[model samples]
Target: MMKRIPIALYFLLAGLCAAAQPKKLDIVFIGNSITQGGGLQHPLEEAPPVKAWEWLKRAMPGSNIQYSNQGVSGSTTVDFLPATNKLFNNVVKAADAFKADKDATLVFSMVLGTNDSAIEGPNGSPVSPEQYRLNVKAILDQLLSSYPGCIIILHHPTWYSPNTHNGARYLAEGLARLQSYFPVLDAIVAGYRSTHPGQVYTGYTGGFSYFKKHPELFIQENGRSGVFQLHPNAKGAAELGVFWAQAIKKVVGRLK
Candidate 1:
């Protein structure tokens, strides 16, 4: 006959088991048109945020996930600046809602700078690389203060045709400016390593170069300048979603 285990010991063992399980995730995606699935048939269902959440579900079985899409058309980093209280307020509300889930880990996945690089049209078009870095840092500072312990992932914005000119004018010069922001993002993440430690990370650096090589993945639009590729097609959105999910998983796994 086996001896009975003490009640206290039994409860401790159960607690240990629960602690070893995967933690639930609550993500807030902040970006611009591409993130919102601007050219997609049904943005509500086909948006990159939705796709990323779907991919994460399959990739991390048994983990509960929730997300909010805060992408706005024609939005720039300046639009998300803390002083604006425009887009940033909405982002706060979304993150606060997720706070109700005490068991879930909060994460902010951001992709901006597309419209910021535009020569015109966007609110803060032609934003210099220095201003762009400051804007992003300010946004992150407010977010960190508002939601302590939340993870922040800054992604490199994807590519658009050199001739991209519709509501906004992003010619070859604009594309070059967009590329300049990449190094700024890298520096920002590096700075956070010392200040915020593991709370901040650089995410999905491949999109810019990857999309540049595959024009087929993007939808060709009849712009003022002519045909141009900006937003990704459905297949591209799915792939982009996978890219985000991979980066998120890497960060979370590292912390785990």
Candidate 2:
């Protein structure tokens, strides 16, 4: 015959155990076709390689977190700006409507700057670096305000084909975008979190380096339907997911 524990003791023990769990977090991934899982029809459950959420789930099995993919095919940064019908506004407004817990941590994983770098003009300007910086800052400022203390992770999309298969399109566009736009974007993130670092980061997905190394290969290709060099195949996507996961893991480590 064992002695029964007091009811108060049981409640207190349960509360302590629950409190021991890591803080819950909500993560949002926003971007273009790659983030939309390569603009193809894959099984719904087969997670995209660019999504760090699934990676996080595997890495931190015990962690409490919610993740969503708000990516669209062929979307530019403008679509993400806090406008009436855009994704940024929609995400924030819906979160507010749902009354997301004030105590829960929020994370934003943003991948952009691909279509923006398309050389639409003779001068090779799709969206100028300055404008890109402005667009990125506007979104960041809005997010920081809407979800105070949220950590922002900005990703540079993977490599583009080197040849002029599209005519001066992004002839070495991956390198051009990195050299031209990455600095401004980094500066903006740094500016926002000057007082409090670790609130923002830039994740380079190695598209430039990978393409530069394989000078002979013009594209990252998959024989699978609708897969192309500009868009990564499942394997390429998974590789990107690794890069993104590295960036997010740093933030996850800090969360209590």
Winner by TM-score: 1
Across 21-115, the per-residue lDDT of candidate 1 in tens digits comes to: 44799999999999988899988888888899998898777789889999998899999998987999999999999998878889999999999
lDDT for residue 249 in candidate 2, whole number 0-100: 72
Q: Estimate each model's TM-score.
A: 0.91, 0.74
Give the worst 10-residue stretch by lDDT in candidate 2.
218-227
Query: Residue 10 CA error for candidate 1 (Å)?
Result: 25
Residue 61 displacement in candidate 2 (angstroms): 2.5
lDDT of 2 by residue, 1-256 (tens): 9999899999998776555544676777777767777534471433353356677677656667676766676666777777535667656754564246776667778888776776652222477788888888888878777766788888766666544323325545644764577678778766866665768876654655775454343334543223235665555566566677777776556655
Q: In candidate 1, residue 56 scores what lDDT?
A: 87
- Model 2 ranges with Cα > 4 A deviation: 1-22, 46-51, 93-99, 121-125, 164-169, 173-175, 204-207, 211-228
What lDDT does candidate 2 reach at residue 207? 57
C-alpha RMSD between model 2 and the true structure: 7.7
Off by over 4 Å in 1: 1-22
